[model samples]
Target: MPEAKETVLEIDLGALAHNYRYLRAKIDDGVKFLSVVKAFAYGNDSVIIARKLEELGTDYFAVAYVEEGIHLRKNGITKPILVLHPQFTHFEDIIEHCLEPNLYSEKILRSFVETAEAKNQKNYPVHIKLNTGLNRLGFDHPEIGTVKEIISSTSSLKIASVFSHLAASEDWKERDFTVGQIDLFRKMTWELIADLDYEPILHICNTSGVINYPKSAFSMVRSGIGLYGYGNDKNIDPELRPISTLKTIISQIRSLDKGDTVGYNRAFKVEKPTRIATLPLGHADGINRIYGKGKAGVFINGQYAPIAGNVCMDIIMVDVTNISCEEGDEVIVFGGPQHPVKFAEAGGTISYELITGIQRRVSRLVIPE
Candidate 1:
């Protein structure tokens, strides 16, 4: 990999391939693999990641919204793109772009049916989302009859798949809850499937679900974070390689005397003589403000340098008094020896939030396999 001259998110396609293959090996031969590439592929480049996954034989691709799917389509993503949380307003565009929507409610289902009919679409693929335990999106158990009736009443739409989301599949203490969710999903889908003439693909496992619940794999499994090299478990994490490396360079270095404060409101007052290195990224670039004031540190010169003051919009000062580093030295914000999970933990967050929160302003450097 090239040394970072500026703040850049280095995307390792080799790691991506390894992660995909590792996850792929966990499932049965016939089970389909759906890769979730939403939130700009978890704050990495979506198009680049999706293209690589597409080449790697991903059975399907999922995104949070129709626009995300459309973006992939425009960028040569030919695999079936499932829009997980589509709005009624974009029904026309969804159909026009050959993107499928996960209809989770009566209103969305009915609206999509109407739109499909108006567009003269026949048997357009649509996925049914059920609310087993997540309580976020998806139709309830009682709504299954209504869902069936609406779909039964329409020739424009067809059930492509039936799926649900797992709320706490990663936590061992939530094992019973996750299992109950899986059981309920199976029972509900069976009830719905019995009423229909054909069986749509059944899926409920997310990345963690895939690792924890193998029997619940059903017809397919959707993985988001796992493909980005996080299994949500410490034991499994070592088996997967993180695909993104957030790196920045020291913009400037300064020596400060005792009691010398740094950043806005003097949030950091040097207790003694200190050397602070200013990095070119801060809150605006996805380094959360909560990571300021000695919470999180950057890896510099084989050592860790904690943020000395409050994170600014475009800059952050790190105490590098002990590190033998200078201006323009490459710093690992997260990745390599400093994992993103560790960085996120320092700020009381998760890797998902930290990675997905990365701003679009940062330059992306793709490291091909």
Candidate 2:
């Protein structure tokens, strides 16, 4: 793959395949694997990532919206695509593309039934989401009865799987809470499936959940962040590999005096004479202003720079006085070694925020194995 002319996220499809194989090996061979390709595959080009995972024989693909699933289908992804959060507004389009919806709320369940009936689809796959402890999406224990009623009443709609999100899977300190969620999901499953003879596949493991909570492994596990790396569990045998590399280049360099201020409103005042290199990416490019004035910065020429001043929309200045770097050289923003800017620590945000926040304007170049 050719290097970016300016700034880009190099997506390694090989690494992606590796991560897929790694995660798949961790679970049972019969259990299905659903790779979450939502948010442009975590802001690294959904079509490309989904294509790679699909080629690897992944059981299913997931996205947050109907449009995203349609995009994957448009790009030749025939593998099952699951829409985690389907809005009622796009029900018809979702039907046209044959995308399955994870019906969480009672409103969504009733709406989907009507839409499925209108579309005249038979046995249309749909996932049942449960709100064990997260309290975000999914039906509660009391609502599962309603869900079962809806499932039985609705002819064409079929319950594909029942899933729940883990609040804190990696923190063993929160093991009790995680266990409680698993137990709750399991308890609710029997009641939820009460009259229905066939058990829809049950999946409750998130990336960290899959890694840390083995007993909770029901029928499938939704591996998102772990597949893209950044998982916290060290005990996971296959090891998670980061599949995306965010890179940018210094646009210019300027020498500064001790008393001189930098960036908007003089957010940072130079403590000493310094050589500052300004990058061609900022909040507009997913490198938010939260890194401004006090955070560590991009690594260049085997040395780390210090972020200085308020991050502008299209530019950020870093103190590179101590490093040997010049304009046009690539700057490692987040990912890779020798600096390894953990996305979570980028600005006190999580990896999901960092990856999903990358601007669409930034070019994404895929590197196939």
Candidate 3:
């Protein structure tokens, strides 16, 4: 809310809107977009993301848990929400909140049907997740008979959508396997309800699938990171601005001698007399200590500055000696033009991890255009 502050996470709603609109424009008319809002919209506040997506006319919202769906429903979100990993124990709460469940295995399928029938809920919307090589969750294609059994026996649960997840849509080396997976899904769905009249919406595309192979963009595309701004494949368009920005200020300025050592285990031994800045942010706020040890850089007065020494739980050291920076100077921890932080290269992890790993400790400040 304040103009400038220490240790803040800035979210650009405009960038979010742009990404949503861009991805939406890419898909065909009949193909709907179900933006994933799980993990607090990848640690950027789900309520805000869900509301924004709804305003952007997103087809649906997907989360990994029932609690997440409840959060959106409580926040006045009446859009179709799919819980990818709905627990059997919370079946009652899910029904109470009118949140749909993705029944993956036989046990979950039977459990959901029984619960819905007992509650006298007819045509209760549900999704059937098939394990199309992901092997994480979802019933295997061979188990289509079980889905048929559930459908034939129960009138309570309705198969609103039958979907699968792509394990490696981004890797071209896995293209053969991805193609096989897609084929398997088609064969399984067709054979599962050959005689039965099952007209559930068919979808099996994640962000990468939506971008690379729009052919599989079936009924809906469940996108998470793309809507958050960084589509793992950066080649999409530079105009898709990263919605999140990490910022902090210099807590202290220490003038180090040429041979001065800094931080735990004396990790940073200065080669030059440097003016190092101690930032008011560190591992505790999701800037992992590994991010230190000369791995990343930050922006100081629109110039680049290298991080010095090991990052601590509450403080990070930046070598701002070349920038003519003074005490209490504003520090931009990447996400900007001068020294943009490449999440993959800097974190040695994927953009998904970098964005989702942002701890709850950091306060999110949303700025809508």
Best by TM-score: 1
Residue range 141-199, candidate 3, lDDT tens digits: 67888788778887897788989999998788999999988898888877765766757
Q: In angstroms, give how far residue 4 of model 3 lies from its true place.
A: 3.0
Whole-model Cα lDDT per candidate?
Answer: 0.93, 0.83, 0.83
lDDT of candidate 2 at residue 172, scale 0 to 100: 91
Error of 3 at 322 (Å): 0.9
Q: Name the Cα RMSD for model 3.
A: 1.8
Model 3, runs deviating above 4 Å: 1-3, 237-239, 338-341
* Tens-place lDDT digits, model 1, residues 1-369: 889999999999999999999988888899999999999999998999999999999999999998999999999999999999999889999999999999999998889998999999999999999999899999999988888788888788889999999999999999999989999999999988887778899999998988988778999999999999998999999999999999999999999999789999999988889999999998999998999999999999789999988999999999999999999999999999899999999999999999999999999999999
Q: How many steric overlaps are in each model, in order?
A: 0, 0, 0
**Which model, 1 or 2, shows the larger lDDT?**
1
As a whole number from 0 to 100, the lDDT of residue 341 in candidate 3 is 34
* Candidate 1 Cα misplacement greater than 4 A, ranges: none
TM-score, per-candidate, Cα-based? 0.98, 0.94, 0.95
Flag the better candidate by TM-score, 1 or 2.
1
lDDT of 2 by residue, 1-369 (tens): 454458898888888888888777778668888899898888888888887887798888899999999998888999888899999899999889989999989898899899889888899999999999999998999887788888898678888888889899989999899999999998998888878878898999988877677556788899888777657654552366678888888889999999999889998888899899988888999888788876757778767887888989999898899888778888888766422235447678766788888889998877788
